[model samples]
Target chain A: MNAMPAREQETHILLVEDDPADARLIEIYLEESGFGDWAIDRVQSIHEALDQLAEQDYAIVLLDLTLPDGTGPENIRRIKAEFPDQNVVVLTGFDERVFGLEAVQLGAQDFLVKGDYDENSLAKTLRFSIERQNFIRRLEETQKIARIGSWEFHPDSGRLILSDQVLYLTKPDDNEVKDDVPSAELNQLLRRIHKIALSGREINLDTRIKISGHGERYFHVQCRMTRTSTNQEIVQGILQDVTDRYQTEEMRKARDLARKSTEIREQFIASISHEMRTPMNAIMGLSNVILTGDGVQGEQKQMVQAIRDASDILLGIVNDILDFSAIQAGKIQFREEPFSLRSVCRNLEQILGTKVKDKDLGWKMHIEDQVPDQLIGDKLRMSQILFNLLGNAIKFTEKGQVGLYIELKDRNAEKVELRFRIEDTGIGIPEESQQSIFEDFNRVKYQHKTYEGTGLGLAITRQLVELQQGQIWLESHVGVGTTFYVDLGFAVEPKLTNGHVVNDVLKSSEGAFRGTILVVEDHKMNQLVARKTLERQWPEVQILMAENGQIGLDMLERHHVDLVLMDLQMPVMDGYQATSLIRRHHQARIRQLPVLAMTANAYVSQDPQLHEKGFTDFVLKPFEPEHLFARILQYAPLKAIRL
Target chain B: MSTINTQIDLEYLDSMSGGDTEMRNTLLHMLAEELPKEKDVLAEAAERGDLPAIFQASHSLKSTLAYTGNTEAIRLNEGIEASSRHGLWTAEDQEQLKVLFERMDFLLVALRDLTSE
Candidate 1:
């Protein structure tokens, strides 16, 4: 035989008795029993007993029939009332056996009359009562943990029998459950249960009830008609609380609905932008070709220039709406690269200088001595901010000077902050509308109504500045001047790198390219624009045209092509598949051919790794003459190579 | 005249057994076997003049009749159970109980006959 492992079994007892002798005798008997270890606490009054029980846990209470503060079977009732799960046994006098029996009916586990039993019997009675009470406690715990209760209904007798756990769940503090529930709701529920029972089907339902003190609660109830052993019809049911799970499912549904609506809005913006820009591409591309034509250098030149300028303004307005929608949808991501601050300033000057000169407005730019020539930041976004602000400065100013000042604010080994101040002696903004000017579509109310704008410029500028972790604000009066101050941060690149190449292509009049150019485009107007632009670039260059990528491939087999200007989104074969086939050609010379992607969708060119798609470079639609020429010159050089 | 003047409906039992005649007969035979034992318990409690015990026994028997659609017996047992609960067993309660016992005898004979068929 193996010895069993000894387990620590300690029972705590509370003896509530006013008589000191009886208390001592009870304690001695408990210690002498030798059944288990005991830690007995004695209290003389019911008040003292309750105080001790409140602070500590006891297995059972041996409550005397008489105490200093209370008497009779009432002590057992009181103990049970305070701690409903407490096990209590009444210790009565020998003549009070009738009272002990009454206390047992009330809810006590057992009763023992003093002097009527030996220590062994007394120990046995106490041990049995504790064990029985432990079983009841465990059953109640299981019921509460599962949040479930059982019920039975007899339709013919109109009698309802509820378990103790059901009474605790529905009636709570009250013992009677039948009257606590609302009569109307209970009648409705029973009607449904009866219908289901009569149809020989089990009843399963989700119901909401209002408990007087507990507010609203949800329950999932299931019941079926069952035959008793004596062949009686009874409906037995199990009800469980399902409030938490139901609410969580509802919240998840709401979140998915919100996410779906946002996706639809983004799709609408993308398609609308594409539809509006396709025609504008043809309008601007053809006008640029006509302006660089060799004949009719008089009023025809001015008319073509006006058409080009109008197309430019229309494209700007369309982009404003597209950009605003993208920003609202949180779709813009910034890029990190080393760019020349001087080059950015020079691009802005070239872009806005002609308009200012035509308006006869004085424009000056000043850079502080400590400002770095090349710093690491998002250059495209930075240039957009300057273009919008400078355009506004030239538009609002009549005759006075518009000045741009740049200064370095702070510097560490890691990063530097630069502050830009663009002051214009324009029709200054009024104090009342200055804050409102930054809101979308809010144009300043001025006496001169000739100024035309989409009024989204300042709003987009503020979002762009904040995206770069910068702040922008303006200070102005009604008539004096308006000065916009912007603070932006940039990481200092120690090793100097050449910034974005300042395109001096407009100054180069060398029509210098000698190669066969293949233009693959599906749209006829786009083909005409590309052919005319390439013909003007190199007067002596031979250009071949294809309606799609298949034709382009067939043309490539027959003709020795030097460069392929590919258009994405075609009829039979799209640019991606065509580029993949071209790169996988058997001959190395054809596989290495430079393919430039031309797209009306400006968003495509934003990706820096367009070269990975077999594209040597990318150009936006509505191509500027100089930008198109500059790209061609880079890939297909002049006949007289500058070695 | 027949001693068993009443007929009990066994539609609930038939449907519960999915119209299987053999299963229904088995259920009817079980009911026939159990009713005599429940009747003895009711009669013993009535003889002892324990109204509470009489009430409990009748309460259980009332539901048994309700399932088999023994409507008259259900009415009689309900009266006895209610009177006993109020501690007032009048002549009306005794009369209903006598009729209820007779109905129980009829139910047992009826169920036995169905099983035999």
Candidate 2:
């Protein structure tokens, strides 16, 4: 009452009492208590009290335990059942003081004994009850908005208390049995709480609970142990519903796992494909050496031709798998260099012309006058794209013609876009299967026969085209032909050079120049192949042999070596380490030695740092004999050609 | 009925009435009339398996018994009320209710003798 302030508006009180004397007494008490501005509405029963409550808002309701219509705690229960938010204080008879306390337990804010209280005490109880009820209401509202609840457990009393919001959040399904005992999930939670209490440590845990309407919900529970002022141990905690965020995180984790597995699979395939190449190099190189050597008879030469052809097909398939996996792993790097566009076309023609003539199919290539002869682009990839399309056309066609047409599509000062059309009169693709033809392992079935090639040819070609910022599409009609159109952009080379520069160098370095070439190779077959290929070309050139880079370095110290064919990926000092040693040698001649790296790894060959790593140049293994000889001719020193 | 065997404390009633003799006498008469009726209601509710009614009767009887300072009866009534509210009517609860009825009968008889005196 001392803390009570005078209200600007009248405070409304609804009194439900059956005894007229008790009602009169309470009215007098309020009047004496200086509640002049309070409006007191008196009713004879619980029903009348409820009706009055519905019609107007009241600051508080003073209920009687024994009413004519309702008695004991039932009167308080009835009023509360109607208006759960209504503040209620019960007035009990003198002997029923315990009933007053029971009334408070049954949702009444406070209780009073009829004969025991003075005006001031009565006023104080009513005012304090209203304030306490409001505070509880606000606390419940805040908890509801945050989707969070609070709980407390006393270890000594074995008592667990949950706030109203906690009760609502953890409500069980209607069909579930209701009992005073804790539920299984609640028991698990209690165990966690007990552990925290015993260890005197704070804990954060994620728990799953089955709720009334929601199937199962995730909750983030945070708990800590603390002692009251009296040193009573208690565990207090908050539970926040985090189902939405948890599910999203789980989905993201699943997606990431799927992507990681794909990467691992691709890496495995790439390594396997790479392993296949070393043996492939031996097969192809040994077969080439056999075909080029002098043979006894016609059947022997024909048998060697079959072996060479089969090896070529197997090598093609292996290369296709390697390239496809590399592209999938995002490891393909395109080189921007200046090269003659016409030269790329000439090479493609020379490579495929014999097959076309043997099949009785006509071959033609037309370059528009406006198309630049020299351009800056990945000349190797551009040649590969054209070769794949033209090769497919020639393989599929039994007769008729295969043609390549190149024309300038668009031009700016910096770059020019060239459109290429490779057309062939072959067994054309069906319209329905055209779109998926470029997908991996999609082979065209024609005349009850699958083509004898890896299905990755077109797929690799399409990926290479897109990687170069180019587009490729095809048009076909069954039994007529297939024509693939490609649009590729390249920066035009600014400098004009004599087109015969390479030929001029070749002419100057004609005939077998005398030089001591050291071949550092681990494989005996590969070393023999290199010796035979080099010795067959330059009969006067002295060739030294070493099993590894360490042996090769030792040989270089003893002899005046003109060149080193450093084979990468060897035991006891690889090509890279050997080249680094030679480049860093004390003698100027050894440091400036022309070290050409030989590798079976296409990835290593494509590395832009190959020359920067002290090697003068690199040659891909299963080497094209002419290309190997040309690279050697450029780097190997001429031993003062005998006049 | 012997008042010594009733085991009822009058101190709570005295304190509640604040030394008002008339108020104390009126409360004793009210308990004498209401105790028997509440015990009957509790037994009937249990017989019919009406848990809500049983809870109400047990709850009211517990409060009424508190005035006599009968701790045993109050505790038994509280247990019965709590179990019934959860829709549980176990054999122990039935036994407790029976004991509560006996205590109420003794309390009612003692209240009647006091009122007459």
Candidate 3:
């Protein structure tokens, strides 16, 4: 008997009853139900019963469906609704079996007749119903998480059409939803197969996908090629939606990506190591050799000096990469101070002097007389960019002259414009190379070491110029030389026009563009030529030249311009970005301005869609001066950027 | 009781299983006697395809091999199962299934030697 005392603690009983007298009687039966260590709660209303539920969670709820507070069906619905999480079994005195069926549908775990309530039936129902409900709950949870589960199987027979029959045994009803999902799976599976053959060189792949939401279904996906007397055939590809399994795996993958940043870092390091090592080693080796080549003489000394300077150039190129990365990562530091432009130019010319002399090239620096002697800027950094441009021009030119031409364009009290153009006569860069030359390490392909470089000079120049709120571009033909230009902005004299040098000259004196000027610019040369030419033409009129239709609209924003010059392609924001912006604005400015689309993009310019946009005319370059001037006269009467 | 051949008389069934009429009649008899089915074979054959009927006939033959503890027909039938990827001729697919079937047939010699003992 004492041994029974310990086992008694293991017994658990739940009594749920609503009628005061009947509830007490059930509680009595629960404690006496041949089970020890039983917990019981009794209340007259379902609400009080639910309140007791919060205090002690029962393994089961035995309830009376008929109560003064609620009756047969209402009482059962209330109990089921309030404690849906609890295991519920109905024990009612009235129409017990009738309410039992209704209660079970309402999610009550089981139903018991008043007289039928016994130790055996209650114990069996509690064990079985709880197990079943838990299984159902787990199934729903998985369906909610992965949203998909699938399986892949390779059949022993190699053709799984036979296997599909096996799966049909499990999900016998063949449906069309299954059909669509299978076709998608088959395509995905075939792609995976081709990829594996190319990547891993593995032959077979059986892939499956499972979709979620009711009618939890699964499909078997298979792929194998077979041959007949005449030809090879795709054997079987079946997609059985094994929804239950796919959910778990995809959720796991998402969790993995969320947790692993180091993996991406490692991959990035692996890809860049080969590129970084070669240049770095050269710089390191050359520096070491220079320090040790002290006793070397004559031609050797000259060669060592060449090697040393080359090493410095290499290090500078590497520094450009590091610095650009820093700028991209938002870490570039700028120091602004007043310095002499003459010294900057002198130092840059000195750096390029030897190469110019070696090539027997004559070089000249022409500065506009009115250009400021003292400039406020990062002097060393500005010199570095100018040196890169000059050195590049000198290196590329075998014969004719390379000139560094600096001229003042415009200056306000707060800002100044200095234009630098480097002209070279050498093997000219082709037109296609011109577009991407400013990109890092980009150079004309098969460019021999005759002009040795890290190929970083132009790219770094572009970056620095852009950083200084300046623009840089090059124009060249196949045999003629290339001319590189830069426009730099410096802090102005800060006096506006009141005391600024020659107030009338600073008065935006006689606008450089007048009436209507047709701007024909497909790319660098056309744009620079058009703008500079139009600026020189009127000297005091409005000037508008667009790299693409998009910029044309931008020029339209504040100016009621007299003319539009459009280039079809440059880069993004390209001609399309420009024309579309114009078309959109034209909707607002109907016939207010005339837009002339200038292009080397032969087909896009002819596209019906181009004219449907806001372009009033088209000009092709090398366009005739008379044609451009004629268009200018035609649109000169209208307000520019109107629509 | 026909002595009930504790080993069972599966040789006749196994030998006839390659769509032979005699094997079909014998498989039907085995299903009627020792095996149980909820439906008839003709309806199943009509609803499914010839390959399934053939696989069923082979599967019944496969069971007969198991019951009698025989191995040769099991080898050829397993070979037929593998070779089915390239059709019955086993002419293509790098002849992988045919090779596998041959190896399986070689493995069956062990079963045959044991049954004789």
Name the lDDT value of residue A192 in candidate 2. Answer: 66
Task: Give a tens-digit lDDT track for model 2, residues A420-476.
Answer: 999999999999989999999999898788978879999999999999899999999
lDDT of 3 by residue, B1-117 (tens): 112232234432332232233433433344333222212331253245344453443433333333333344344544443333234432442253334334334434433433344
In the range B1-117, model 2's lDDT, one tens digit per residue, is 123444667754543333335646766776676677778988898899889888767755654565566777776887787698789888998898888888777777777777888
Docking class of predicted structure 1: incorrect
The lDDT per prediction is 0.73, 0.76, 0.52
Candidate 3 CAPRI classification by DockQ: incorrect
Looking at candidate 3, what is the lDDT of residue B18? 22
Instruction: Assess the local accuracy of residue A201 in candidate 1 as a C-alpha lDDT between 0 and 100.
Output: 93
Worst 10 residues of 3 chain A by lDDT: A498-507
The candidate that achieves the highest lDDT relative to the unseen native structure: 2
Q: How does candidate 3 score on lDDT?
A: 0.52
Could you tell me which residue pairs clash in candidate 1? none
Candidate 2: clashing pairs of residues: none
